[model samples]
Target: MKKLLFLLLFFPSLIYAQNKTGGINWISWDEVEAKMEKEPRKVMVDVYTDWCGPCKMMNNTTFSDPQVVQYINENYYAIKFNAEGSGEVTFRGTTYKNETYDANKAGRNGTHDLTRAIAPVNGRIAYPTIVYMDEDFGILSPVQGFYKPEQIMPILTFFAENVYKDKTWEEYTKAP
Candidate 1:
């Protein structure tokens, strides 16, 4: 009884803190949208397939960076979405799903409609795309590729600070 009571008192908080240790608090699309309705915040969507190598590397490095994690948590609702995974999402009025997904082909299933909608780079789909969006799900950019912590920080801050509003990325990065 005492052990049960002790766990009930502390286990949840411990797990919550542990999850935040060197990791971003990745929420779902539904949750992010719901939260945005009540309290608007920027969003970062990590669209990747499970079999993507650079995607795994990004998860192991950039997303794990302490500074990156803290800054994203403070200013954005981060979502780690699987590009070829099962799920239904209704975004901007239309519903999306992996209609061509074959359970036997989990690793290389057809792309989810949500991924098609959010992660195309110049009309091409790429693994490990990092999409940034405004408070109302308006896409700011769908930057595709793997990046180290140092490489991603500037991009994160560019959106976080609204620098993209006044200056183009080239101009912003070129300035001293």
Candidate 2:
């Protein structure tokens, strides 16, 4: 009885310890707009769908990296948006929602209008896209795919420091 009690008490702590790692501070789009108005900061939106494998991978790996989490928390208003969710969001005086969403469809519901507006790559949407916006809510870029921590570090620094104005990505990457 004592052994079983010990195991029950200790196992939950072990699980909690293993899972208690730092991660990005994700906010909603409405909160981002409200916060930006008072104290402006660059916005980084993780445009993801529930069924995207790459998006889950990035959330587990890249976004979970301590350095990436700290840098993003410090420099940007991080938003984790479900691209197919039926939540209404207002940004820059325009309201966006998933008008044609089919909740019964499970993983294949209609995309949210905000995701379509922000992540359009030649009129197509891609999962695991990271959309960057300036302090004024102007889009900087929508980068797609699952990027490792090292691969995403430069992009984060470039935008955080506003280096895109004068330096091309090639020039920025080549710098020591």
Candidate 3:
């Protein structure tokens, strides 16, 4: 009887302890769209490819930061998108696919049409693009490259707070 009583009290605490972590709650694109339809919120899409080293680094460090995780969870619907993976993903009324994907291919593979349409920087694509979108799912910007936790915080805030509407990136970053 004592063991059963102890088990009942301790099991819930153990589950709660395991649940706490500095991790972003990543969701699928379809889930994001459905949730936003009922209640709108900003979106952050982590566009990554399997062979990208920097992308893995950000996942280990920047995205793992407690502050970043908390802020994103509170303010945005996050999506971890595989830029080279196979699939048909429709955004803004258009469907996209990776035409050159080969199952046998090892390291690097074809870029998805979704990546070209959303994550390009000056007509070129790069991995680890942190794409921010508005509450309506309009593309605010695609911030490409790896960033440290502190470095990414301001960028996250700028989009979350809608500061981009009033100030340029330079102006927003310059302010105290």
Each prediction's Cα lDDT score? 0.90, 0.90, 0.92
For candidate 3, lDDT tens digit of each residue in 5-114? 99999999876564455478899988999999988999999999999999999998888777888999999999999999998898878889999998899989999989
Q: Provide TM-scores for the models.
A: 0.87, 0.87, 0.87
Q: Against the hidden true structure, what lDDT does model 1 obtain?
A: 0.90
Encode model 2's per-residue lDDT on 60-89: one tens digit a residue.
889988789899999999999999999998
Give the range where candidate 2 is weakest over 10 consecutive residues by summed lDDT: 14-23
If candidate 2 were superposed on the true structure by all CA atoms, what would the RMSD be? 3.4
Q: What tens-digit string does per-residue lDDT give for candidate 1 at 58-166?
A: 9987887778888999999999898998888878889899998888974688899999888998899999999999988899999999999899999999998999999
- Supply candidate 1's per-residue lDDT for 71: 94
- Which candidate leads in lDDT? 3
Q: Which structure is stronger by TM-score: 1 or 2? A: 2
Decoy 3 TM-score against native: 0.87
TM-score of candidate 1 on Cα atoms, chains taken together: 0.87
lDDT for position 25 in model 2: 83
